[model samples]
Target chain A: MGPLVPQEIIGADWNLFIAFAIGIGFGFVLEQAGFSSSRKLAGMFYGYDTVVLKVFFTGAITAMLGLLFFSLFGWIDLNLIYVNPTFLGSAIVGGVIMGAGFIIGGFCPGTSVCAAAIGKIDAMIFIGGIFLGIFFFAEGYPLLKDFYMSGSMGPLKVSDVFGISGGVLALIVIITAIVMFKLGELAEKRWPREEY
Target chain B: MKTKYMNPYLAGVLLGLVLLMAFFFSGRGLGASGAVKSVVVAAVDVVAPEHTANSGYYSKYVGEGKSPMKAWLVFEMIGVLVGGFLSGAFSGRLKWKVEHFPGITANRRLIFAGMGGILFGFGSQLGRGCTSGSALTGMASLSVAGFVSMMVIFGTAFALAFFLRKNWI
Candidate 1:
């Protein structure tokens, strides 16, 4: 009943338009939360600020719960919604590389774009670097293709792996986020410094 | 000294709603890296059409019926730029400056930012997504890829935090 594109409720042209609108909201929220600042984003690791953790986990949990309820009420068909397939080796390795990038670059792809929008010269350079990195990956694809597609575990869900329902997993995530929020607050207090 | 940020929880709810709307209307969740990939492909095609056609990876995104800029992610990314600009303007955070720590020079910070971006770009290709695409949106769909990406991205950052302490703290 939902996922208008896959269900053919919306045309491809409209899908592109919708992507733009969604991106606006996504960027607005990110900027409002101070995600445009590398210092603020990096603060998540140093305990000077926990806005990243708070916003990130809260957003994740809210989306998880929303999907669960939407499915329960038949507002949207969960099956039609795309689930990212897991490629275990690449996922872990890529994530690790991204992690290093996060600490070093102090911005992710989305946030970096946001930062650049606000006139951060560094953000612009970072974006340039992304292009170069991607170009490098493409040129070297033959050498890395095997590992890139390795450890295919299909599109398994976290709930499926844990032998639980999606709803239950959502609950666990919400609870866990709350606990982490508390710890984040404590950490900030213990390591208070000038605001980033 | 400045406008306070929206409550994190409220911001989260709003973000989630935005994400939900994305799935409902587009049949897919949010993404960021894909936009960059589109740009990369387009650049390669423009500069070296023959090379792009010859390469397996570049060819996939080029050739007949393909305008790399026509992708949904590209439009979305354009919107992100607009939205960010608007938000910054309204919040009075719109300023032309290089953001960095007092301990570091702007040049140094920018260099690191570039290096970091290169790493993230390469990593996103390998990982199949960046934070927004793989970690956040993936987690929303309950995909293991989402959780693993989230864990490793954050875990590695935390592990390397000490080494990069001079950059931030």
Candidate 2:
């Protein structure tokens, strides 16, 4: 019923416009959430701010639940949405690398863009580094193709892997998020950092 | 005076709604790295068309009437820039400065920032997405890849936080 562009309800010509609109909301929310500040984003791991933890999990669950309801209401076709395909080796290794980057760099690609928009010099350099990093990856693609293309699992959902319904997995994740939120609040109290 | 940041939960909900809108209208979630990838692919194609044509990786995205720069993600990213600027302007947060800990030199912070960006950019390609494209969007769809990426990325950061304390704390 939805996914208007894919379903032909919305013309293909409007795709870029729609994408721009969505990005606006996304960037606005991120900036408003203080994701523009690398120091604030990095605070999650330090037991000081914990805003990242709170915001990330809450945002994730909100979307998850929203999708479920949309499907239930027949407003959208859950089957039509894109789910990221899994490549176990790259996923794990890449995640580890990104983890190190997050701690060291303070901002992820999206957040860095937002930070740069507000004229953060560090963020601008970070973006230049991103460009160079991607360039290096492209140059080395011939050597990395084997591993990059390995362990492909086609768009498998967590519910499918666990042999549970999507609803059940959503429930469990919600519970987990609540637990994490509590821990986040506690962490904030235990180690308060002055607001920047 | 700078306005206080929005409540995290409220911001999260707003972010979630935006993500939902993306899925509802376009049938995909939010992404950041993919747009960067598109730009990279485009740049490479322009610099060395034959190299890209011969390369296994770049070939997948370029050629055959496909214009990488016109990608949906690219337009979305441009919007993100505008939106971020608008929000920053409204909140009185727009300023030309380097954000860093008082203990560290700005140059040191810039160097780490660049290094971190490089690693993240490389890793995002290898992982097929960064935080927004993989972890957050993946989790929203309940994909195992999403959960795994989320756990590992956050886990590694937490594990290494102590070592990087001098940079932030």
Candidate 3:
């Protein structure tokens, strides 16, 4: 009954409007969580501030549980939702490159956009770099095509792999999040930093 | 009047609800990089139509009666910019400044920021998503790609943190 757009419950005309509305909430929450601060985001790795860890895992667990409950309640069809396809080779290698970018740039694409919106000068330049990088990737697409298309696992689920229910996995994730939050708290105290 | 951030858990819950709403209404999770990609595709299409028409990667997104700029992610990204600005205004955090480590020069920070963006943009394309699109949304759908991306991205960052200590700490 839900996933209204795909189910035809919500008209196609409203799709873009809904996307914008959802994005507003997404951006508002992110900024409120202090995601607009690159230094604060980078603080997670340094043990000075663990806000990123606390916020990120908590958000993921919340959505995972929400989806599970929605499915259980028949509010949404889990089958209808989009599942990201897995390409192991690219996933791992690409993540490594993104990780390097995260440490070096201090902001991911989403966070960088938000930071730029708030008038962070470095974020603006970072966005320019993103455009250039994408341009290069497109121009060189012929060469990287094979590696990019390799190892297509086709939307594999962790639950399917573990032979467990989504709920069970979500419960484990919740427990893991709690433990991580504890570590995060400890780290914040162990290495407090004056405001940057 | 600079206000403090909301509690992390509370903000996270709100973010989660937004994500849930996305799935409930659209059958897809939130994304950030895809919007950027759409822009890139649109730009390439305008600059060199024949090149985009011939290129395998760019061809998928461009064609007759279709405008990549009119995509859902693009609208969402515009909203992100507006929402971010509104929040920043409300919290008095809106300022034109370069934020960086006290130890690093602002110019050096900008240079790194640009380099980092380049790498992230390229990587997101290869990986099929960035933090929001791949890691968060994928995990929400219980996909292996989501978990793996989350782990590897964070792991690599942690591993490289030592070498980049001068930049952040």
Report RMSD (Å) for each prediction in the order shown.
1.2, 1.4, 1.5
* Pairs that collide, model 1: none
lDDT of 3 by residue, A6-27 (tens): 9999998999999999988888
DockQ of candidate 1?
A: 0.87
Every candidate's DockQ is 0.87, 0.84, 0.83
Docking class of 1: high
Model 3 docking grade: high
Name model 1 segments beyond 4 Å from true.
Answer: B1-3
Which of candidates 1 and 3 reaches a greater DockQ? 1
Local distance difference test, candidate 3? 0.90
TM-score of decoy 2:
0.98
After superposition, the stretches of candidate 3 with alpha carbons farther than 4 Å from their true spots are: B1-3
lDDT of 1: 0.91
Cα lDDT tens digits, model 2, A1-196, are 9889999999999999999999999999999999999999998988888888878888899999999999999999998999999999999999998899889999999999999999999999988888887888888888998999999998999998889988999999889888988998899889878776
How many steric overlaps does candidate 3 have? 0
Task: Pick the winner on DockQ between candidates 2 and 3.
Answer: 2
- Supply candidate 2's per-residue lDDT for B155: 96
Q: Which number leads on lDDT?
A: 2
How many pairs of residues in model 1 come into backbone collision? 0
